[model samples]
Target: MILNSSLLVSIEKHFCGNELLNGEMYMEGIKHYLIDMDGVILQGTKLIPGAAEFIQRLRTKGASFLILTNNSRYILRDLQVRLHDLGLEVPQEAIFTSALATAQFLHTQRPGGKAYVLGEAGLTTALHDIGYILTDQKPEYVVLGETTTYSFERITRAIRFVMAGARFITTNPDVTGPGEGGIVPATGAVAALISAATGAKPYFIGKPNPLMMRTALRTLDAHSEDSVIIGDRMDTDIVSGIESGLQTILVLTGVTTREQVERFPYRPTWIHKSVADIEVEG
Candidate 1:
């Protein structure tokens, strides 16, 4: 559905209001919400203030939403446990990760394909679940994903595979991500290293790519016009939302700050100080 100018204006006015909510403000047009996980919900293992409450509010109102993440380190169960440990209740079905998105994309591209994977349980499990064979033996694709410690030997093997004509695929384009000890090299950084070595670039299948957002919307049975994307990054989340034809909400609690946002050519539909400032109730 196309979001007309009047509807966009109404959304802007609703966010600008100081009140928590007016009657049916959220239920009026927005039925689905796509939320980012890392900086928007939690920074590393620490929960951002009001993150749990915001999710609870969605659950309480029976609203449709999904916690989307580009991190391909852990599987859905791991993420669900982590959120539970942080006092947030998110079902596995309500969470979507880049690992899952990549796997889905690959499954559609090449069914039962062989891959040489450099990732953790998340990436491996997703591919395995989709009937992909994880091997270094003339793999159809050399899949790069996030890992705590990237192995030089494995990267060497990946380069060799790419040189041998295997396709290259990476989970996301995030060079660094927040970890327990500040920032760490993510999938994109590792993919860059491999690309530099092999002179072959991997197809990134995560945020900033509208494919990821489109798949998430399909999973949620949501339409862009009635859905909202809440994220902390302008490059990935906001751009992807815009490309996917969804209203975007930029939160200052993540990688992109207000000043950084100003540098971007386009703007989000709304900007909030944090998730705490957003009222999902109506």
Candidate 2:
């Protein structure tokens, strides 16, 4: 049965136990998904309700997907371990990190190049796998990524390298990340400090930078018209998906709220409580 716009809001419907939700939501004809990991899937270290179910729904419908994250601290294996510890099972190839995108970007620009890095296993491993050498001796680029331990000594070296004409690059533009107590300094925060000292701005290669989105789509072998992105933050995930020509779904389970969406000029195609509320038609 067809319903008018007024009736869609006044009456609720359900199919196969999934509620037909509101808020510009539409999942029909979506053959692929690009989902944000931190907010849309798991908040902190715990799995968000319905996250696994959503993945299962995608798999059941023979859809392709990739879990996207801006955090560059851990490699794919590390992320797999963390997700497994949280009672969630995700394939290693199904996860994509900003570090990987950064490495890919550098590989294309200057293959087999040297770089001075300030990150954990994730960033360094990605750079290494891309045939890029990690060095501090007159490197071509000074790469920055998220690290649990922020060292003044390493940051100082990065600043000096940038001052010496080494191009600056960062994994993501997030200034802060979720910590036990509150928000903590991230790659963007340190990038800001380095910029202040050297007067050189670094290129960001994560969400909100359609570059990463396009790279991910290529990895999935999927087209934007047939893909959908589910994220919580409007500035990064939503904006990047919109700019990349993919459908965007904003979940309220993370930073952005229902009322806060009105503040942005651009709007997500859909807004829901969480991934669980989303209906993926089979």
Candidate 3:
């Protein structure tokens, strides 16, 4: 279902205001695609239309890709199961998470370090897998991640640890996330509270940081000039990709709408309706 080059140009002219793009990805096609999860492929536990097809297209072209998600609540296996139940066959290894990135960064900085964790199994297990000890007894770091079960007891403990000279780190800086009822405070919100109490700012490890993108890109052995990042958020996904020197595609199927694009000072290399509108040829 690849659209003709002329049709692609027309869409770009209307949305991008340029018939030709200004990146290495123009006409050459993408070698690797760093795709977002919640908004691009899935929407509230359901697979978006054309998600599976887009994945299949990539596989058929022998392209490299990764499912990059900022949600540190679930591990790779958990994500695979969720996507599997939703009719997508994404492999566990193909998923890159903020928890994993944070763990990797910490491991590289201080091997076998200890931390006071505030998150779910995803974050805990990532630290565990890296051979890092998790404890609240005057640890070396105070790591915060996405957790639905936020308790005042834990928040106070995190603040105390940070105040006691433990370095503060967070998974991402997203202040809000979609909850069952509506928008609810996420890791960023909780991190702010801890920061306010301890007078300590946290080092964020996820999108818009560019470190996460570089790590993920290195994992795939993909070069930035020939890669593309597709996402729904203008703040995290698009900015991260642009900063990391990769072409960015802002898809409308997720959190960001077409109108919201004008608000951001930066623009993605391309804007498509969805993954369905993007096709690659080898």
Superposition error at 206 for model 3 (Å): 0.6
Tens digits of lDDT, candidate 2, 47-105: 99889888888888788889999999999999989988887788999999999999999
The clash count of every prediction, one per candidate, is 0, 0, 0
Task: For each candidate, give its TM-score against the true structure.
Answer: 0.89, 0.91, 0.91
**Models ranked on lDDT:** 3, 2, 1
Q: Cα deviation in Å at residue 274, candidate 1?
A: 1.4
The alpha-carbon deviation from the true structure for residue 29 of candidate 1, after best TM-score superposition, in angstroms, is: 0.5
Candidate ordering by TM-score (highest first): 3, 2, 1
Off by over 4 Å in 2: 1-24
Cα lDDT of model 1 by residue, 185-268, tens digit: 888888889889889988999999989999999999988878889999898998888777787788989789888977987667
Q: Is candidate 1 or candidate 3 better by TM-score?
A: 3
